[model samples]
Target: MSVNPFPEMDSVSTAEPEPSPFDPIPRGEPVPDWEEARIVWKSTWNIHVYGFATIFLLFTIFSTYRFLKLYSFKAARMSNGYQLKLGLYIAICLFSLLRSLVLFTDAYNSWNIFPPILAKVLWSLAYPCLIGAFTVLLAVLLATTNACHRGKSLASSYKHGIGMGCCLLGYTALVVTADWAVMYSQRSIFLLVLCQVIFIAWGTIVMIGYASIACKITRDLSRTPLNVDRGLLRSFARLLCVCSVIGGICILMKFYAAVSTFSSRSESEDSPQPWRWLAFETTQRAIECSMCLLLILITGRADRKREILVVPKIMCNGITIISGLESGTVLKDIRLKDKQIIH
Candidate 1:
């Protein structure tokens, strides 16, 4: 038997192309309402769970850095900026780890007919971390200000700082209150929107404060190189701004999509919005990781002697050289007048 000259190739070319895995499937029959709900719920939960994973990875890197620093630095317990910063970072890492475990369990157990009570408990535990992060952010902003440690009489500055800090705290509280209200409304979309607004506003205010402080430092120490890595500082600032804006946008988009779905009672089983949440979560975590990395660069090899008490340029017109000194290393008794310096 002879083979046909034109085999199945001709027919295949005329026939409609078979749908590939990558090809989009056209909507056909409507899915059951209950099945659709389950699908949406699972998809949303998956996104939320993936957010935890991203957070965990960021904190893991930070924790690893902290562990190494604690090991390498002999004076880790000293009451210095390094120690304080390390403590804050470590605490954040621990909090993230705990949250990760809770969210992971929530994802796994969400398959139950009814939501698990344990998941609610786990979420409540995360509330503290949220508050703590905001608090630390405010502190960081204050630290960047000249009022933190400045002038012949910093009493005034201290009072001002306290007042400003309280204001920030109040703002954070309002945000938290809004979050609870939205969440209670059973509107996940609104909750996400509220969270995004709070975080973005916080980040923006902090960044502006930081830039102002950095500028003051530069202007005062114009003669000295300042030794600060300008590139690094700029990178950190840009990262903060970009992450805040991007995160806000992503969250808002997801919130709107969810609202639309709920309002229209759309029966579309497959939801792509969850993927958007995953992306936002990933970006936020990446920013956290970058922050840890920047901190490591600043404090990893801190020189004790070099840790000069930053004074206003006017207070010490003379260049102060800071060098590493072993513990118990004492400087010769040189009579120097006490002068106040702003950060």
Candidate 2:
């Protein structure tokens, strides 16, 4: 029967406070349904990405196996060119294996089979290996061409080794720093853009290096004598050109991906179909596998040529001499009788 004079106070006391727009999600709680949907969609696309990585892994493993088998007994005697190639193959195997694992973890993370953080950790580990592999591959290509022309290993130079090591370390540090900034800092977009810029610069430098090497090889091939194997030099030059083209394409794709990601972030958009990104990654992996296959084939041919030109020992005047029959040449006889008597 009595009217309440403090109705506004009672209503205010009973009403719940609205959440702030800047509120952080509580830990150990599910994200919004939309966020979960985006995560699932992205992770699902990782299945195709990892599938391509698996194929690349198989190719790297086969390459490493073939290289090892081809040089099984010659490891100790391998030139710097071969050693660099061996290192490149090993690094690629590690990179591909880690990359596949990372992608698989991402795919599984969507289903809660693996933690999301695990995929990030795997990626962090894999990226450095990728840089290392790329460094070694570049070194091998340069060294191979130089060795072919000089008839000696350029990679054996201490200065060259030091320069390569410094470059690898510097790039690894840059990548790690960029990844750390992306994962931990609030200014992720700026850091991501910086990383992409760095990548573009690196790609440009690599393309230039390949171009110069290709040009030098072409010049040498034109002026080299008929006895030199022109085909091998041409093949290496072609490979360098191919690599440059592939690297340029990858850089452009990466730039596009970075632009899209930044635009999506700015728009507060989620659940952009993952297929576009995954398709780009799949194409990259396929190209890498094909390049590795080509490298293995080319190296195999070089090894066969070396085997064919290997001289057989012949006994002459109770002393050993190397026959150059396969090479269509003769060598001066070394009189070892006096040296043997002195020994």
Candidate 3:
């Protein structure tokens, strides 16, 4: 047997070489399970915020669109008396649009697809818009009551509006500032709790005052019964009250979370209790969910008409019998025609 001197000739055909590690990581396919899971979570929160914001957006959009069309046609035909309410409606429409846009942008970008700097900057920008819209809303509310009086003068109404707006702005600023402290400084959990408590207390006061003034106006208007649609007005008032109460509760929850957080904080660690974080997060989400539901309900077509006053059915020993009024506005779908109301 001849020994093969050229054993090298044993392997002949060529095959493709393996890729190098230096090669770029190929872009991932559609989405992996982990990625998909993340997306689901993200979408859940997006829906939480968007669900409510979208409701407001669509309601305002259709309302504004129809109003503009009707207003144009009426003006052309020279009929249908217009009032300052038109301007107020327009402002509210714009405000709703702004809020929706801000929230939408924030949510969409929260996916981390954006650069960190951009994300932070956008987040900062979005929150201020929310605050601004709230401020503007309070202004509009006060202005609408310009015809009302607390005592001797109407000037007080305007001042009251301005004051309300300022107070909200101030409260918002403080809250945001404290939030910054949490993000920026080594402030103890106790400080954070204190900040939250102060912020919420002031905010609740402002909200209470706001509701009182609003109810007063509604009462005064009802005496003469202005031609303005009471159904819509009452719905809005109910929304404000419900939202304010929820907001107050959310703030209180934050305080509770903060207190728990500090209680668990060690002098050495900058971090607070893990459970506190969890509680805070849960409460925050709950608040968001509540807001979303309310927004959707606002746009829904239902005439709940929660009456605010109730009378006693019977009396008890040493106690006055009392009953409560249902207080909510049922949303109704209405069609509008050129300078005319349609079924």
Candidate 4:
């Protein structure tokens, strides 16, 4: 009677059910071939990579052109300040190129076209390059300021610049080593947080330096000679302020990312969403390139022949005398009157 009531249930097989399409492969089955498996699992091409590559390439080209044009100018080669500025521009170009390569490597790694190790290596290299470029920029700013305000040549600041550059390089090396060690050996979240915190502090200091430089320029503009374009100086001061603010925002974003990662318990949560991270990265790059371009323009205009008058005081005195003579032959008349009075 019980069998009759549950005939359909009894008829159902007790053997393991067939695997559904969404189900994982059964343990008894042979593993799929790598090529076949990859074909099935491969992700779509990363559009962010293409966008980043294009932006960076364009920036690199423009920067290179500007650098070449500036370098070709006789004045640029002759002036220590101009040379320092050229160095900064070249460093920016290199940074952009390296960033593009790093992005490409990362995209290739994600597509399985290149090994993940290549991406890691490129990232490490790119990070150092970034630090170096930043250091060069800072040194240029300091040297330029000293040259303008204190009448000190870039050559005089060489010792200080070298010391600062070495310190930054050493710090970057330590951070890179710690990052790799933590990634490979310990994988400690605390260590990661500490590294991020240290980086944040360093970045903050750099931004503060930028802000201070901006303020100094603004304060000194009133005392700057009329020969220097006041408008250009003001624009440069404003640009520096903008850079400092933007840099601060970037630091805050990095801090937020670190906090979010620390709070997240799962790997998925810890990892930034692709589109969001891509947008952040793109925005950051765009701002950086734009700032560099603006810097080039401002400096170029400032370096124009008429913007800064380097005429000697002797030339100025001669010119003043010539102008006085042109107004009237007063000196000759005075000499004739003196001769008549003596007779």
Candidate 5:
């Protein structure tokens, strides 16, 4: 018998390296076990938030329908800028509802079941919409207080709406490039959340200031039945402030999540209270929904005020009947005239 001098050669064997359990982490693509994330949400989140979110979604849809009816009912009362402001408000509500729906779907799937590009696009669209909503709010307050009113002023709300559309486009471009080019890295996401938190806080302050002015102005209009009281304004401001704080907390959690995710600490920390994205989203939607419901209530009350006076509902037939034919007049003149028929 002879002992082999080099035993290292004898140990060679046939085996393949383990396949990737998931795609690159930067892509934010979920691994196979990502479905287990549902358990994390189930254990950690407040059940009530979920309940509120459901109610909110349904209520918002109903409110939107009612608002459209209200628009038709008193079409002549609202100026073009005013109509545009209301339209923007609806857009905000729609976006908020969309976010809630996406969150529910994410929880149900236990991961970002949304494709990377789609996920990025949706998120990108969200920020601008949210910011635009607030911008219109500010614009309305400014308009009501002074000549800042668009469709009625040099600085038009229509321009703001158009600007927001542009913003959405810009953000979409940025996010698509970032997600694909940069891998949606932890540092980048963390920084993004941090900036969002700061902006949220600042925005809350701005909202409070503007809302205070709006409330004061509304109170002076004793003759107008639709004048919103200071109480409602205060409530809205307070809610905005609260949401801002919550936003900060959520950003922190997101930062930690990004950190843990990238460092692979999630595997080692077997804690039951796993911070979850779905839970954060639920909380966010709960707060936002509450705010939106309040706005809907206010708008609904304002619109129906005439009903209390027993005004009959205006019915618009599908016909655009015109009186004397003015050849030289442009489309604007007709639109203005059409808008003059009040309920």
Candidate 6:
């Protein structure tokens, strides 16, 4: 964030006029080919946003790995339901790592080097992977909410979120496939806006699902103890809500920009460059992934003395054992090198 993500022009324009969906532009005017322009713009934005993002994401990767190792070593000591939720969170982080790697690599790859057909197919597969990763995140929250209100009719809400997320994931594949086809055939801005529409709709649905889950989590948190897990849940809910709200704003801005490109103009320079803000894509993902990784670490941490987490064997070999964090059960086994086994 060397540069301000948002402009310092007072407040964001809420009442600003939006680009009209059915606006009539002259037939002779051609929309600027953003596909070609984006390569350069992306590089520029990457220099600012991705520089910070890459550093943060790398640190998150290291921290997440350390947390996972610590957690797994003592996982058996955790309650079954707590253990299961932790595992789900771990799975989500691992998948996010994979997605980040793929996205980082693909960002710099030139689609022009390969045959157009093959390139198009690979490109089409890319966004769906991103969408699937998001679905996994939503699934984590969905599971959390269900856990908080177990045996209640919360299943319906979780199921609906899952269903909606899965459908959106499927829809990305269609958008990519159709987008490639239209780009090759018609080269129309209409097709471009249509793709944005689908992307926005998909994002909106996912955000709505998250917001709903956050509301459920809020009610549950009020009655829950102020434990480390509860704290992490609070952090998770806050991060999700902030991200969803900001993401919604960005999507609206993008939509306005998408429509701007279709406006009638004598020159490309005169048209609004809606896609300029698209540079934040990588940065946004990095922030999200980093936030989740933080929550995972916080959840796994042994923040209290006498916290009983590790196995009995781990209590051996001169190792000091404390029991109280999770279960009241104390470690019964003890051993020290060059000395009799102490019990």
Each model's lDDT comes to 0.44, 0.54, 0.44, 0.54, 0.47, 0.47
Native-referenced Cα lDDT, model 2: 0.54
Every model's TM-score: 0.47, 0.66, 0.43, 0.63, 0.56, 0.49
**Residue 37 lDDT in candidate 5:** 52
Candidate 5's TM-score: 0.56
User: Model 3: what TM-score?
Assistant: 0.43
What would the per-residue lDDT of candidate 5 be over residues 1-343, giving only the tens digit for each residue? 9998977666654355564644444334223244465455554444634565577568657757765665665542443245545655576666667666655565332455876556655554555555455545545434433332223543353464675466545654554555554344444555444444544564555455455544443343343223223354345445545544543453454455455544544254442333544545556555566545544543343344322211111113312122111122332454465466432
Model 6 deviation from the true structure expressed as Cα RMSD, one decimal place: 16.6
Off by over 4 Å in 4: 1-47, 70-75, 147-160, 187-195, 265-275, 291-343
Structure candidate 5, residue pairs in collision: none
For model 5, state the Cα shift of residue 38 in Å: 5.0
The true-versus-predicted C-alpha distance at residue 292 of model 1, in Å, is 4.4
Candidate 3 lDDT over 135-208, as tens digits, reads 34344343333323333333244443455456445655654454444444444334445555655565565467
Q: Which consecutive 10 residues in model 4 have the weakest lDDT in total? A: 318-327
| TM-score winner, 5 or 6 | 5
Residue by residue across 250-343, what tens digits does model 6's lDDT show? 4575566455545543244542343643444444555555545544443443322244332111121323222223442322221122134233
Looking at model 3, residue 330 earns an lDDT score of 18
- In terms of lDDT, the poorest run of 10 residues in model 2 is 325-334
Residue 15 displacement in candidate 2 (angstroms): 12
Which prediction has more favorable lDDT, 3 or 5?
5
Candidate 3 displacement at residue 145 in angstroms: 1.9
RMSD, each candidate, Å?
A: 15.2, 9.6, 15.0, 13.5, 10.6, 16.6
lDDT of 1: 0.44
Alpha-carbon runs more than 4 Å astray in model 3: 1-132, 147-184, 188-195, 225-237, 260-343
